[model samples]
Target: MRATTEEDATARAAVVARGCSSPIRTATGVWVRCGSRIKSKCESCAELYRNDWAAIARSGVFDGPVTEFRFYLLTLTAPSFGRVHRVPRDGGQRVGACSCGVEHSATDAGLRGVPIDGDMYDYAGQVAWNRDAGLLWDRTRRRMRDRWDSLEYFIVREWQDRGVLHVHAIIRVARFEAPTPGVLRDAALSATAVSQVDAGVLVEWGEQARCDAFRADGDGAKTIWYLSKALNYVLKDVATASVDAPIDVWRHQVALGDAARRMRCARDCQPQDCMNLVHKRYGSRSQVVSASRRTRNRTGWSFTGLTRTVQRRLRREWWESRMRDEAGDDAPALSPPPLEDLAARSRRELIARGWSAP
Candidate 1:
């Protein structure tokens, strides 16, 4: 019994050391790492996720002929629903008086996103905007492509302290017709979309948009780094509001949640009965990160064709090779057992352990 317990403890330690805190057995009877992107859930997996996307982002800027393309880092914000306190971050300079007639300090961070007047704040409009944000972006991108035919982009959607979604995009275009940063910013900001669900509503971006062109060999690396860092924000399950939040801040989040819960995510959605995650996510239904994909007529977002799938395949091959090398030529064949046999054996073991087998 002691020997068996010791062996089990050693196996668990090995798994932890390999950065797989949670391993799940697949239908094929192979155990694999749970690919969670949230750092709080699994730091190792989250780091891998961040690193994979970062590599893909870098490939888009560095792999192709640098001088042949123009790169721009663009930021777009959501339209404000109402006035909120503008408290600077820790160690940041103080802004002037807020609309409420108070110069907020960093210590007032708890009220940063809280509405100045809860009754007047457009909670319904904010939630509705969040629901339609993806559609708006689709229209915006199409409009931009109409002017610049060679546009390819990678975007990360970040949550503002005010519980709204904003965009940070790395955009690439052929140099023949690249526009000035100011022009690009103007064009993007001017683009708008009509909501398909709520036909009467018009979707638009806030006036706080920016676009900055950078050289692929110079500021481009720094721009990529900045966007890559935003990936960490994407891992959060929801808005930053917490249980111990200030009363006003808590009420603000509650209002957003209530708004989201009642908002129609789809044309056929029944708010009370819908099980969609949109209700729990502050009315946003879009993915946190995405990139252009390769098509017959396009080179895709990554110039070197480095994507998460490619990274995974490469990692798996390297891992297998290392395992074989460690086993040595004198050892038995390091190849895995046949899938069918493994599956049958796994089923029997599961049944013996009083667990259902798929």
Candidate 2:
């Protein structure tokens, strides 16, 4: 509100409808949402983003009608250059200790994507792999056509336990040829043979490449939920890391951040570049969940069409249900005001007469 004493008017006052200069207050007090995908940067927004992705995954945009189509989960990993800190699932049954001498805890975030020996770790190879990962997947998709007439796939890339990027994809085929796991794996490996990393060299998927079909008889929602869970894990794992960790521990983390900065062209990349796609979708200031063009494009599996509004509503419903489950149905619902209403308006727009006294 503003007031002034003018020669023509004895004390004119104006009530300006403008956003509060200060942050908005809620039941929890004044809160500012950073809207970051990284949980450490902003927990609320990251959770929201994660929920949005889960909603999209379960929405069947790529996976299709659960009852009508059978889905396959395929993981194509990058080849390893050397030993790295790997938190053994069986408590060091696989490998006694990472050559780094540190027995990484099962839950240690720092240990997952770091090289045990940084000096010997192939940073050049790692960068090359990241750059061409999309191409590799393109080949794999082309080859998979031989097995199924129609296919829908959603692929996400994440830095593996060894700091190399790997893809986790959900493939849906209508006919259900039901190829053995080895068949799909062999096809993916064969696709890698076509990759021309160097004139004389070929890039290959890591030995850990896996191709497994979802249980034929499982509930539709459950199967989709499981894929969504894999997606959520990838999103969370790619979130920003603590800088205090050792160089090897956080090396790939740094590379990922750098790649995101450099790779801005969506058309240049496939579904593998999650970080870059994310940055392009939402600018640096705002980070929301997003899927890749590869998933949405006609090249992959298609789903029964749903209206945009319906899709959004379904996502919202899923989020609400998740919230209810976690906090109970009686929990307080905090619905923020629409952004347009809350945002500040221009002075001319706020003024009733379309003009203000000089």
Best by lDDT: 1
RMSD score of candidate 1 (Å): 5.5
Error of 1 at 224 (Å): 1.4
Q: Flag regions of model 1 displaced more than 4 Å.
A: 1-17, 241-244, 330-358
1-358 per-residue lDDT for model 2 (tens digits): 1232132121111111122222222222222222344555445555555665565555554344556566677787878766666666644455456667766665665566666666676655665565566666777777887666566566666555554567777666664564666787787777864334344447667777787777445644666676566555655644445666656555655654554445433445443544444433211221112233334345333244333335445644664465457656686553432222121233223333333221
lDDT of 2 at 258: 52
Leading candidate by TM-score: 1
Cα shift from native, residue 69, model 2 (Å): 3.2
Q: Model 2 residue 305 lDDT?
A: 38
- Any idea how many clashes model 1 has? 0
Tens-place lDDT per residue, model 1, 1-358, is 6796555434433433367565445454354455667788778877877888888888899999879999999999999899998887887787889999999898888888889999999998998888999999998899899999999999999888889999999999999999999998988998999988787889999999989889988898798889878888778655554666689887888899999999998889899999887898898989878889988999999987888778766866665576568668896554341221232346445534543211
Cα shift from native, residue 343, model 2 (Å) = 14
